[model samples]
Target: MPQYKLIYFKTTGVSEFVRYLFSYADQDFEDVRHDITTWSKFKPETPYGVLPILEIDGKTYHQSLAIGRYLAKEFNLTGSNTLEDLEIDSMVDTINDYRILFSQYLWETNEDTRAKQKEQLVQEKIPFYLTRFENRVKANGGYFFGAKLTWADLFFVSLKPYVDFTIGFDTLKNHVALAEHAKKINAIPNIKKWLDTRPTECCIQEFLDAKHKD
Candidate 1:
């Protein structure tokens, strides 16, 4: 019964960003999850006909990213200043760019092409982005963006597992810098505790099954 509450689909796609914030902050909130059969009813309640809605102290937070930023800033997660925030936003944008292809791959029907796309990701996109991100890490003085672990860092850190193995940033192997970032995030005591006790989501396996189904 914390001040913020999040409503999202049972699946992980859209709401996870907000989820990471609350979890990292060790804040409490109501989690309302709706299945497909329940989405029609759930959709209309949101500001933009979306499922993932954040209500802060009973007021509604419409956009997902806005909500994440708000919560992050409130809990000392965002950057120290506008410049740092911009860097964090840039990293977030990079991940968002790749997510476009992720959505495309999710709905694509062709079998051979999908596999080929995955391979392409593994070869050109994965390594390229990973290297680019790795370089960006060094350029920005290590971590994701700021010297301190901001919300942006937590958000991407929360997402690193999926990236290292999923369609977005999944080209990691002997990636020293990137792996170091991941390791650092993993070592956060609060995060470590949450990871140990968090509930399971089947959508992870579902994503794999759906992609490889062809």
Candidate 2:
């Protein structure tokens, strides 16, 4: 196996998917996390000056989803064929769309605007996305795409904490299938091990607290 190094912030954030992909494959990797205070010092050395860069052997690659797709393909987590790959990619992209929506609400500069956006996110966006995902999970017999686990499952599992923190509630509570799907993924031996030992800080909370004070 080639050497894998992932550089991102101390929080789960975008890099969490990459971590989960590795964990699911039982592949060892170097997870390099940078605290906010020290990021500037390390920023210039990054190719795109961004978090969530993956280094294979010695070459670095940028873009979170791009890295995820590559790793999914590498580990056979994508799917067995082209059509399945398309479904998996579509689900991943849809999840990422919600991620961007949450980011906007989390980091909004205007208090009123943030408040409004948060309300919409919690009331409208969360339900819309989670309900659809819940249906998908139920339809797939607990997984997102097929009879077995895929990168889409890992991606959704990695988003649970952020979803809860941003919505200020257990968004999965009313969605039994989705909740069970998350539980099932988390129960996977390797993914469970990673989750048990990973950092405990709630990055979403810290991010909001910092933004609120500014």
Candidate 3:
């Protein structure tokens, strides 16, 4: 088996994308979870002071996006040329910006404060970004930026809870185009089969379920 390992906390929002990528590509990987104490002990092995690191072929890699790009190449999910890859990179970057402000820092604010943040994100940011991407999807006539099913498309389709866990709020369910975009990407036969057979992802689905509960 190819030795693909990812060290991460129990949360899935960050790690889940890569896991989904690997699984969809039918790549076998080891996902090791670390609590804070375990992470402190493991830090020396990390190139940086980060919990999420990927190891392949006894070589370690850092930076979440870099890992994504690496896996994209391995699976042939990145675009063909430099410009195409740049466009894919651009879309992923925008989503990352939202994640840094919202998902990563979500629980830090009080409920009332977070509600206002959520309102702004849902009312303005969500529609604006999704609509822009929808236009891009229309432009590409199928995919996000590369005129094909790139890793960036998978990344966005997997991102359903950036603003709010509720499909209506975070995902803009009213926007049929964006919804269809997500559905079409995920519903690809190979992806759907792989998803059904794959082991449960620890953090991502759990978080979505938990959000629905609260």
Task: Pull out the clashing pairs in model 2.
Answer: none
**For candidate 3, lDDT tens digit of each residue in 106-206?**
54336677777767766787677777777888888677775678888888776564345432343656667777888887797766875576554344444
Per-residue lDDT of 1-214 in model 1, one digit per residue for the tens? 5487788766556566677677777788788776655766667767788656877778887776777777878788777789878878777777666655555665566778889888876667767766887887777667776556766566656655555445644444558887777678767777777678766653555544545665
Clashing pairs in 1: 77-151
Q: How much is 205 displaced in model 2, in angstroms?
A: 5.3
Which pairs of residues clash in candidate 3, taking residues 3 or more apart in a chain or in different chains? Answer: none
Give the TM-score of each candidate: 0.81, 0.93, 0.79
Model 2, span 87-165: residue lDDT tens: 9999999999988887787678788998899888878998999899988888888888887888988988897787677
Q: What C-alpha RMSD separates each model from the true structure?
A: 3.5, 1.7, 4.4
lDDT, candidate 2, at 199: 80
Q: Which 10-residue span in candidate 3 carries the lowest summed lDDT?
A: 161-170
Comparing 1 and 3 on TM-score, the stronger one: 1
Q: What TM-score should be assigned to candidate 2?
A: 0.93
Pick by TM-score: 2 or 3, better one: 2
